[model samples]
Target: MTTTAAPEARPAERRTAPAAPPPVRRRRRRGDALGRTGPSKYLAHAGVWLYVLLLAAPLYYLVISAFKRNTDIFNQPFSPFTPLTFDNFGLAFSQASLGTAMLNSVYVTLGAELVTLLLAIPASYALARSKGAVGRMVERVFALGFLIPGFAALVPTVLLSISLGLFHTREFLILFLPASALPLTVILLTQAMRAVPAELEESAVLDGAGPLRVLWSVYVPLSVPTLTVVAILNFLSFWNEYFFSLVIIGPDAALRTAQVALPTLSIANAAQYGVLAAGIIITLVPAYLVYAVFADKMESAVLAGALKG
Candidate 1:
């Protein structure tokens, strides 16, 4: 104890305090939420706007060109400020005999769509209901229809039309379009119809509902959106159909569809851009109205699905 006391108290070991942490640079968040998340969202928005511009540019140019004179169209091109005129429309109608062609297009499109739906709905229902090996085989056969290119079918189709004596007649289109559309129509509707709950179908059957009744009461109601989409797609296809109309219908004004008629204006007018554009607009009007009318069904279907989710 004396020795320890005597041992000169060793200089108190200097204890070093912990060093202060380096200051963290805090990022300023406006309203605690406006901090930059990423460049991707802004990039996506820019891409969408660019896509909009690309699509709108052609339509804008077409619309303005329809109103413009040839010289104005050539010179001003994209300018909507160019003088507008109704004369091109009149010229297009008269020169192309577009009024008659319009009527033909309506008849063909409506007829084709009706026939296609009638055949497709029943066939699709059969396919959807059947669970046999044969049914799968049949489905595969239908799928094969898609592999046959449209151009490849041209020769055989023309030959068949010639044999049937339907060549150069609009009637053949009414028949031929359905044949081409059946595969897609049947596939889509079959898939859609299959989505109907089996329990619902059983309940309906217990309530004395036959297959037809079940279809009309249950499947049809649920599949309206799909039907609308099919109708719209076929309408556009039949309306804008040119190659077959030109080939089978043989440029006959009495039988030619609107799509085929539009080109005659060019041949007759020496490529008057305004008149051609006007004809294009005229042909497009019916298609536009049809699409507008049916588009609501599609929108409702989408909203319903989102709400269910």
Candidate 2:
């Protein structure tokens, strides 16, 4: 009976369940996204390069054509290098009176820039601090100059100069150049001046500095960035001015600026492309030189003002 009970008591083997499988991870579609993104980035770079090439092409053509013989220019339009010659430059320097014209341009530009700065600096300072309706009205009036096309004012300005006996005079041209620039200069300088801290002025005053001393010592030093921009703009405008120079200077070749002289260098039948190009290149040199020196300063000045404000 005990043996039978022991046999009956033998336990059934324990049943074991199989382990569950782990979840399958969804792989990221990174390769597909990268493939799509690659084409767009390449396309953007290509577009920028194309645009740059288009802009540079004309200047390239102009320079290439300058070196080419008249026949070669027409036959080989795409060729950049020609039998490089100084003949054109020689002719421009010797015959075009470009040297004299350069002098005239320099004189006129310097005069105009000086006059514009002299007038603009104080006006800008006043406008920056002003709070009245008069100040607002003045600003609005200055802004109107931008809206008005420069060519539209040409006739009236010429007529006014004639009436005032200012026609055919360099004095008149110098005066007029600054007058033309004043509205824009005032607007730019005023905006820049407004960005300056009031505390700077207050601190200057606390040190027993007068308004003039404070402006010269503090405001002018701080506003150098804006001033440089204004000066560069004024210089460029004055330098490249042909229309005003032509109309105001009479037929006197001696009074003509470099821009006016360059086009007239060619004879009516014999157009000298090389000489014209050389003259243009020479004219561009000063502007490029000025830009090189002042470009970083100009950016920093404006950026600093913007950040402080």
Candidate 3:
């Protein structure tokens, strides 16, 4: 009777023991989860920083090389930290034809972005709002473009341009470049337009606004971030474009884009690495400047997309 009574009392005491607080239990759980994972937070951050350094090294070299002489660059390749000079820049501007190329690039890229947005906005809105068979078929066809590489269509596009008597012309490039934007622009705009509430569109219609008015007033304002993103993307693509520009507008010095002009720098001024560097940097400036000016818009676009996602 004494042994059985003692065992019963021990069990009761164990059941009454105080458990850990909620916060303590949560902390323990999180720690256990992290332990099961591969790396700690500090180790992960260290790896990321290391990757960034590796990526940035080439950009640093390019910038520094732009200020040094070719001899200095080849002899002391790693000594880009030395004092800077502007002679390479002067040479680059004079020999690289950057002045002419930059103006042409600006015109081409701006026109491309404008035309792309105009075409994409209407198409995307239609696809997003309509659920008809034609709309679905059109959407699938547009999506198919993504699987096809630009290079694959080069010969066909060139042939088509020649047939239309529009080959090797700025008009041809402006029209051609915008077409490339169609697939991505349509996809992005459809997603963005779909996110806008249908009730808002109906309300705008009830308020005595026409379709055009509603698009400009209601949809445009709501879709600004997405539009900005698409415009920026198309702008960069047109600006950096090399192949189409080369093939379409070849031997036409007046129509050569910035990227097309870059290779000519090395060819014309053989062994002048510094001039080549400066020309490359010159090509990059306009894009960077545009990005900097629209930096706020970029941040907002990213944040809005994140929240929507």
- Highest TM-score: give the candidate number: 3
Which regions of candidate 3 deviate over 4 angstroms?
Answer: 1-53, 294-309
Candidate 1 C-alpha lDDT tens digits along 1-309: 334432232221111112333233233333333236576767767798899999999888888888889898888787788887989999999988999999999999999999999999988888999999999999888877867668777778888999999999999999999887777777778888998899999999999999999989988898886787677767777888888888888888988999999888888878578998899999999977876776655443343323321
**How many backbone clashes are present in model 2?**
0
**lDDT score of residue 296 within candidate 2:** 55
lDDT of 3 by residue, 23-120 (tens): 22211332243465565766876798899999999988888899997778888887956668999888887886788888989888888888898899
Which rank order by lDDT, best down to worst? 1, 3, 2
Model 2 residue runs over 4 Å out of place are: 1-50, 68-77, 267-271, 296-309
- The alpha-carbon lDDT assigned to residue 43 of candidate 1 equals 78
Winner by lDDT: 1
C-alpha TM-scores of all predictions: 0.78, 0.77, 0.79
Backbone collision tally, model 3: 0
Write one digit per residue (lDDT tens) for candidate 2, span 84-191: 666766667776688888898899999999999999899888889888999999888887766655677888888988999988877788888998788878888898
Local lDDT at 152 for model 1: 70
